[model samples]
Target: MAPKAQTPSKGSKKAVTKTSKGSTAGKTEKKHKRRRKETYSIYIYKVLKQVHPDTGISSKAMSIMNSFVNDIFERIAAEASRLSHYN
Candidate 1:
C-alpha cells in the first residue's frame, strides 16, 4: 500500500500564503490613501514683497512677477534656439 502525503497546518508563523493583490504591508485597504499635504503659509506674499521691489508685496503681484519671469525665459529660450540653428 502507498503512504499518504502530509500537509502543513495553517495560522502558524511557518505557514505561507499568497500575498493579496495591490495590498502592501500594514495598508489593508485596496485603495492607497494619499497623505494630505500641509497648506503653504500665507507669509509667502510678505516674503516676496520684501525681496521684490515696486507695486506692493501682494500675492497678485507675485503672480504677475511669475508670468513676467516665464515670458523672459521664453524669449531667452527662443534666442538660444536661433543661435543653435545657425550653428
Candidate 2:
C-alpha cells in the first residue's frame, strides 16, 4: 500500500531548516590559529675532578652561562613579537 503525497496545494519549494548542532568543519581551522608553547634551550657542563670527585662545575661559570642564555631568550622573544605584528 503506497501513501499519497499531502502537498500544500502543490508547486511550493521545500523549506530547509538550519541544523541545530551547527557545522563542525570550521573548528579545526580555529585550533590551527592557536599559539604554540614557548621554546627554550639549556646547556649543562659536567666535569668530574679526580682530587675532589664530588666537585661539579664552577659556580662563576654557571652564573655567566645562565646570563648568556637569558640574553638569547630575550632576543628570541623580541623577534617573536616582531613576527607576530607582521602576521
Candidate 3:
C-alpha cells in the first residue's frame, strides 16, 4: 500500500518570504570590464621588415601608415555594424 500524503491543517498558515531588489539573495548584475586590444602597427612593421630587410620607414611615414590602417579598420567596422543592424 502507498503512504498517504500529509496536507497542511486549516488552522496553520504558510509564510511566504519575498526578497527585495537590493537584497543579496536576489541575482546580482555584474559589470564586466572591456579588454584592451593591441595595435596592429607593430605586426605591420614586422611584416615589412621581413619582406625587405634593407627597407626602413621614417617615424613620420610610420605614423601616416598607422593612421591609414586605423581609418580603414574604422570604415570596415562601421560597414559591418550597419550590415548587422540591417540584417
Candidate 4:
C-alpha cells in the first residue's frame, strides 16, 4: 500500500514551497496589494492641457499618454541614477 501524503491544515501557517532551483520561496510571487501613489508636477499638467488636437482627446487617451510619459521618465531616471554613481 502507498503512503498517504500529509496536507497542511487550515489553521496552520502557510508553508513555504521549494522551487525546482531548490531555493526557499514563500509568497514572493504574490503582487503587492497596495499601489504606489502617482503625482505629477504642475508643469506637466500645463503642457498636457496646452497640446490641442483637431478633436479633443478623450480621458482614456489622456490616461494612456500619461502612462507612456511616466514610463519614459522612469527609464530616464534609472539611467541618470546609474550614471550618477560613476565619476
lDDT of 4 by residue, 16-67 (tens): 3234323433434543579876745444556756884233555676677778
TM-score, per-candidate, Cα-based: 0.39, 0.38, 0.52, 0.42
lDDT tens readout by residue for model 1, 1-87: 223222234443244434543345447655567998432324545565578846455567666666676678789999999999997
Ranking by lDDT: 3, 4, 1, 2
Residue 49 shift from truth in candidate 2, angstroms: 13
Instruction: Tell me how many clashing residue pairs each candidate has.
Output: 0, 0, 0, 0
Q: Candidate 2: RMSD over Cα atoms?
A: 20.3
lDDT at position 24, candidate 2? 53
* Candidate 3 TM-score versus the reference: 0.52
* Candidate 4: residue 66 Cα off by (Å): 1.0
Q: Please, what are the lDDT tens digits per residue for candidate 2 over residues 1-87?
A: 123355642423332222322245444444356787432222344323445667576677677766777788889999999999997
RMSD, model 4, all Cα superposed?
13.7
Winner by lDDT between candidate 4 and candidate 1: 4
Residue pairs with backbone atoms closer than 3 Å in model 3 (clashes): none
Q: Is candidate 1 or candidate 4 better by TM-score?
A: 4
Error of 4 at 9 (Å): 54
* lDDT values, one for every candidate: 0.58, 0.55, 0.72, 0.60
For candidate 1, give the lDDT.
0.58
